[model samples]
Target: MKEKLVVFSGAGMSAESGINTFRDSNGLWEKYDIYEIATPEAWNKNPELVTDFYNQRRKNILNVKVNQAHLEIAKMENLFEVTVITQNIDNLHERAGSSNVVHLHGNITLAKSSGPNPEKKYYPIKSWRLTKNDLCEDGYRLRPHVVWFGETVPMLMEAQNIIEQADYFLVIGTSLQVYPAAGLVHHAIKAKKKLILDPKVSEMQVPNDFLKIEMTATSGIIEALDLMR
Candidate 1:
């Protein structure tokens, strides 16, 4: 029987592929600050700056390639029922051929109007420097299709369901500092196996079922896959 493997990934998984995360290796937001770029007030006060911040993020996503860890997780899908639950905003996992994926942080490559379901939910973005001039069909401001700090993650319940249904769980690269993503460990209902991969020790507030694998996401994912076989 094929076992269900649920993978939870974060910025570190895509870092090796040249994707800059919201934070740096030292845990600082790169190029922008949380206060100016992620808050609702920021968007309300200066919509252009918020859009511009996400614009650069979109461009940055285009420059990256899927890393070894992303490929390894993709390859594992062939052997087992793999479902990836990633906190990354980039499209690396999709590009790597992983069919079952969940993006918790939102995708950098999509755009949507800021108003209440004004008409469209997904728009393929061509550039990262979005200005006030960019308009949607409803003529509303197009915001980055990201789950900002103050907004609700619409997929959290769905992701929780995925985590609860997993037979095996693998958590990679996340610093586990943020809410919701950090809280997922609380849901592995029937999960009998757990492997957490990170170079630095994680502060995961997990129950006794999880085992931390101390290593980088690249080398650690490879190592975990080898052990699975």
Candidate 2:
């Protein structure tokens, strides 16, 4: 039987593909206020602004292609039972042919209802734009299917379960700063090997046992795959 490989990825994983990282220097946060664009209150205050922000992000995702890191991770499916648990909302992993992916935050490619039980249903946006006229089946406005600030991460438990069962746990491009999602790494106690791939790995506070590769995701993933072999 193939061993289970759980890869936990963050913003830096897609940075090479031209997607902006949130907390990094000159990132999106530097240009836009999080409270005004990424919070639930933001959507309530000005849904149009929130909608447009995500629409532009969606358009950017559609324009960019998956990088080498994404392709390498997908290729690992040939050697192990790989499950990608990503903090990113983009579909690059899927586009790169990674069959099993668990999105921790939420996917920007889809929209959900603004009404009660919003998570109960999701609507796919045919294009980059999702206007106020776009309403769900319940007659409520369709909002970006994202886990905004002050919102609960619905897939956290599922991610923990997947991590616990991993034989090989690989953390890529994440600074391990975000909560709940960052804490998921602790669940990989059973993993025989734990590795973190990032250029700033030395600066980050990861467990001593974790093998850190200080390189960008694109280059780091190649070395990571070599070690696995």
**CA-only RMSD, every prediction:** 2.0, 0.8
Residue pair clashes in candidate 1: 55-128
For residues 113-222, could you state the per-residue lDDT of candidate 2 as single tens digits?
99887999888899999998999999999999999988999999999999999999999998899897899888998998899998888889998878889999998888
Best by TM-score: 2
Distance from true location, Cα of 77 in model 1, Å: 1.4
Residues 87-127 of candidate 1 have per-residue lDDT tens digits of 98889999999999898878878888888783257787876
The models' CA-based lDDT, in order, is 0.81, 0.93
What total of clashing residue pairs does each candidate reach?
Answer: 1, 0
Worst 10 residues of 1 by lDDT: 19-28
